[model samples]
Target: MPRKKANETKTYVLDTNILLHEPLAFLSFQEHDVVVPMTVLEELDYIKDSKKDVARDARISIRSMEDVLHDATPEQMTEGVTLAGRGSGITAPSGKFSIFSDLELPEDHHVFTSNENDNRIINAALYLQEQKSPGQVVLVTKDINMRLKAKGAGLAHVEDYRTDQLISDIKYLSKGYHTFEGRFWERVKSVESRAEGRDTVHTIAKNILPEAYINEFILDESGEFAGLVESINEDSLEILDLGVERLMSRHAWGINPKNVPQAMALHALLDPHIDLVILTGPAGSGKTLLALAAALEMVVEKNMYDKIIVTRSTPEIAESIGFLPGTEEEKMAPWLAAITDSLEVLHKNDENVKGSMNYIMEKANIQFKSVNFMRGRSIQNAIVILDESQNLTASQLKTIITRCGEGTKLICSGNLAQIDSNYLSAVTSGLTYLVEKFKNFSGSATLNLDGVVRSRLADFAERHL
Candidate 1:
């Protein structure tokens, strides 16, 4: 085998899951040779015909691979086709791509079953290692078990595909709220306070402030004070008084704030200036309930928007029911059960006012939509609630957010710890991504509800189980 220099090209063997996780992952390895194990291709073929997001990604990966190999001859492909200029808008790199149809396994390798696809892929990587110099062949996978198996097979290098991970650790994710120490109200009132219409705006010294972002919730260390950051500069900071009294008294539809975080969420939800709001917390934390209540209040009572659009991503809970029957709304009812339950709660005490749950739903003008059909449509002057957003990928989040037109307010609520998508983790979830990306934006806010108000049993389970 020929030994390459320190700056020489390296080969990355991609797992099928990596390509499914990111369709364009091949373009990320700049100036490195990429190998597609034939077994990986076989797995992709098996999954390409499904109606799931993974299937769509597999199709896209197949197309990208085809486009890259369009002009390469069979001999050239075997000899490693140059990947330079193959990716759209990507700068050409001195790398190559080839399909590893051959397999080579060590004589003593016995950790993995020979019939398993994962083992076959690992064996392909082992063959590449044998063909290339030591430390030049690396196996890239998102599956932890597969990486462990590769290491057990005596491979030199194995790593997780981290190109799409925005945050490396879950602990560092933004909590959307911060607490200040040392007489917070005294410090805030001492600088400057003025009434801007019904809201009071307060200015604070730059030195006393913690690293705050626009619209981020600011609370006193005692948990009695709450305010929203209006603006900030190097010299000073301005925060709009959240008026805790007003928040506590404010009733959306029929729901009231049950906790401090819920109060902050309601304030952000009803604020006319804020266009985006994200609520993240544990289950039974009143995230979806608060968002729905506020959305109804805005659309029905205040007439701030035309209607309410409710959508969510449905990654199968256990086993998929498969190809639901009926109209769009009917087919989506199972997934929209949460919205329906919230509606029932909102209308529970409104028997005299609305008389029927269907009437109240109609009066609210709520529309249930699936996340799949949201592309290429512009949602204007509507409150779009994306529940269970933790199941969405970053690319899917971008598509949904971009669909928001003028006068549209988007509210995304999800429990990051309850994510169902295998491709998404707490740090890489769409909800977390939005929190990190929109933390500094003036028209956006986030709330992480800590209180679980569902019931004593639910709270106990959340804490213990």
Candidate 2:
């Protein structure tokens, strides 16, 4: 393959994982040719009717391709068809979208003699590289091994599918709080403090914390100052003073904060003013426990919401769940054991732990729901806890978040390091996307619970493993 010039158009060969990662991935290659190999389509076809969670995505990808090529004849399909873009909101590609029949590729042109699907896809890209000589051909896949194989097989341009990746590195991701070196007040030259009903509001110059956004927490190394960014202006910021002692003393359904991070997470979770609270951290960091405790406090004690809906997505949890024998909640019980374990810990001291757990589960009206069943419904006056959200795609998160109607609050908790999806990384996780996108939203708050309060052993494992 030749190097692609800035003004020249190159052909992009998309692997099945790319389409599954983003159904409209073809349209994402703006103004560039996209070629879908027959083997890729065959893989999609095989996955579409399966019990896997990505089956819907495969079907959507197939429908999108059909919408564009249904009327085109075989000759035009092989040659290429113009992408309409339609209602996709993406700019129509100036180049063409075509399908290639890898099965018909001559054995003489084969890069690998194996009939494996990956080899077939690589062979297709190699064939295109040969046929489109002098024109750059890139294989876009999410599989790192696949890219290595393609490169080793002599394909010049191989890249990861990163069209949806927001940040180049995870270190740049927001931790929801900024800690100053010494005392935060010592560096401040000017400050304006006033009483707002029952709370004190301080107006400080924006340059002090230039990147501060609404509801972002601000702290100092002195361990005495803690404030939340209430509002931001071009020149200044309005910070709501949250005394560190008060923040540490906050509790949710008898669950007290074990550290400053947990305290901040609990404060965000219990805030009725904030509609969306996202929690990210390592395993054993109390992400799920805090979220669940807060949900119970709001739903059962404060009556802030009518019900608590718990949902999480893992490849095993989302697939073949219908075959389980029981009600929806029962079917989800095994997958949502973390939530139940938290419930048990919350009521472990009761006279009858089992009875207390049952009573609280009923009293709170907590419902365990599948992500698949959560779509196409208006969730009103409820608290939705989406656990293990790092495994989800941006589109998948959008589907669930958009379902929240009026009076609904969503608490998304996930460990970016523990993403189970093959196509997702810490940088590409939907949880990361939500945190970055909603950081400035006044009604949303994000927190990274850095401490592992689950156990001392868990903390050691989190650090070493």
Candidate 3:
């Protein structure tokens, strides 16, 4: 246990959403006294038996909490139990874990009523603030409104749980590329060229683009040059030259690039050497369309992979999926409609559109799956298209990414602006985490499709709205 200093150790009261967002969140506070409000426990108990996706997380959180406090006596439960040897790194095993019973707060003592769970949690924080006296008491939650209410009710310290947030602002996130104004050669004082098969590799000074990473694209205003950063050394870098004309003419299952960003995205998606491709952009930037096209081409035309697996997270997937009677694919159809829509767009000009769609579906062996059922499966030799990835947390994405076995390629695509999860933001999203973490990996590539090519209205809305 960490040595306690007078009035320096804080008591952090955790809300239910924090545990739901991350099952082991309680262990993150180092050397601090962690308190779980009784109201939060009740909410977890109620949600544990439900069919929601978070039900499993609730069970895990309960198990983790019980494992820490199971042997504690009734009096010890009210006091804090030592959290030593339970966690590591950002998770401090030196903290004290306890449960706070806010329901016993008298009417005169309570600042907020115990009728609602949020209010009750707030009252618990207020109670701790008074009880702890000179020490600090903070309400840590992912809910914005709850934080506001806690502060309004006279709780001095309130903070959003930010252990998983890798970046503070979305603008600091990598766009997978760097653009040099005018000619890129003008800045390059010297270079060494070599031919490796059909591709030409160029060695240049690292100062030319010191911030470049592996598989990152390099472009210029003149539109004459485009290169991929293949390797980075101590004082220099190696780039694989990909001419602009060649990138623009690249095709994937009859879909052509409409812009340079799209061209680079298609290039990354088509490369068999790249195992993971992350696409991020605004709505109507063709993230899904490009991913689907590349998957179809690689699976059907190129015969690179045996099948295509498509999955995404939906709010109602867990609760409504089981109640809606059908096979796994049929039950997942509603959520995977975006994939089918892209297939139609790909084969729209065929003689028989439905026949072509059915033929391609069979030929490629496309499978629609739910994020809820992706656990404990070793997937191999397939192209996995994970759409709407911005809504996923880093741990949730890790669960799916680790399932990819040998010869598997995972394409993660999402719009950071369209995050639907209450606890997630553009910078804290799993997509952002994946891009930043894998940018240095040689087998991964990221592309930020810049334009809204769906229609004129989409372009205008993306800019103005």
Candidate 4:
């Protein structure tokens, strides 16, 4: 065993799940040494052949390892290989990467007989710590239980890999809307409005507006007189008037907005200029309903889109059903009950619309597709509604959003508080990521609905239980 020098870099032993979450996460560690345990490699080998996104990530990581260690000899691999200048589309890692296959734990060690992959990985980190200094070895994993085990095994360092985490605090995550009260409301009202093309723009002092992103909603304290921040200069802010009355009057397949957030959501959904709309809140907040209603309106009444493409992550439902039998749409039928429920609600509203649900489904040209098969396809002239988006990872969300082609608008709806993915949280959910990233984009809008309009029971449960 050797004592670590003051300038010696830390060694990070990565777990399989970290690489599966982000194949190129090693590049984020800067100059630290990254070690992959042999057990992790074996797990990745088993996973790489699957058709899931994790399998794709495993393959990408393995390929990246090959690209970096292309010319390295067997002896060189045991010692370590430089990962410098090998990263694609990102800054190269400036540290060494090595595979830790040799375990030298004591016979009486508590984890010696554990036989679990996590225990084996933790043993590797322990070996690294015993060979070097206590603080020199760290176990980096996404698994909370594994991290706890590492800490209990006398490991000095353990941390979650945070490469994909854009925001540290969930509260700081923008809701994409701000309300002004008292004198601030008066100042906003005083701002002169001028016609700019099809939009009415108002120029106000930057101090009055403080901080706002492009297309972000600005409402008065009474929830009336809403405007969208169109542009911002150093001293002045330009806001485009959001005609709430017009949005309220507009019906989408016989469904009109019931609240302020719903109205803003409708405005974003109906506006051709807004290519991406994100609706996030608790259950019964009308996220999916508003999105589906808007899709029906745009595709059926306005002929703005050729079809309505609906998809959602079905991890929970898939586990329950195990093996589903049918065509793609039929296989996705159970998971898309939300879509059917919304359609039924819409049908109940308008009896004059011939044939009700049948006519709406036929005339709207709706398609139920799986998110699993959405890769490598261009969705053109469609309103793509991605329901239950909180279940998707950031990478998966990126893949789904990039599938949008010309004349396509994407509506992403999810309740961050109700994330079904085991690996995701309110702060790390793809919905939160999109809301944070696209807030500044002029072509995107985000609406965080507050109240639950479904029923008193649902609202009470949401508040108390």
Error of 2 at 255 (Å): 1.3
Q: Which parts of model 1 have CA positions greater than 4 angstroms off?
A: 1-9, 79-94, 102-113, 185-190, 317-322, 352-355
Could you give candidate 2's per-residue lDDT for residues 1-465 as a string of tens digits? Answer: 575563378899999999998998998887789999999999999999987778999999999999999999999999999875443555656578999999999989898998999999999999899888888899999998899999999999999888778899999999999999999999899999999898999999999999898999999999999999998889999999998998999999899999999999899999889999999999889998889999999998899999999998847645668788899889888889999999988998899999999999899999999998887999999999999999888989999999999999999999999888777889988999999999989999999988888899999999997
Model 3: per-residue lDDT, tens digit, 1-465? 675685898999999999998999998888888999899999999999987878889999999999988899989999889998876676456878998888888887778754899998888888789888999999999888898898888999999888777788989888988889999999999999999999999999999998889999999999899999999999999999999999999999999999999999999999999999999999899999999999999999999999999999877435458766799898888888888999999999999999999999999999998888898999999999999999988878999999999999999999999988888778778898888889999999999998999999999989998
Instruction: Quote the positional error of residue 18 for candidate 1 in Å.
Output: 1.4
312-345 in candidate 1: lDDT tens per residue? 8876542233478877767778888998888777
TM-score per candidate: 0.88, 0.95, 0.95, 0.93
Q: List the residue pairs that clash in candidate 4.
A: none
Off by over 4 Å in 4: 1-8, 87-92, 102-112, 183-185, 188-192, 197-199, 243-247, 316-322, 349-355
Candidate 4 lDDT, tens digit per residue, 1-465?
574463478888999988877888766776678888889889999989865557888999899877777888878776789876765454557678888884545665535476888888888888788787644888999788888888988888898877778899888888878887843456654577799788788898888867777888887766457788888888888987766676577667677888878888888888999999998889998998889988888888888899999999888447323378878888888899999988877777576544688777888888898888898999998999999999888888999999999989999999888877767788878788889889888899888888899999999999999
Q: List per-candidate RMSD values in Å.
A: 3.6, 2.6, 1.9, 3.2
> Positional deviation of 260 in candidate 4, in angstroms?
0.8
What do the candidate models score in CA lDDT, each in turn? 0.82, 0.91, 0.91, 0.82
lDDT, residue 305, candidate 3: 100
Error of 1 at 320 (Å): 7.8
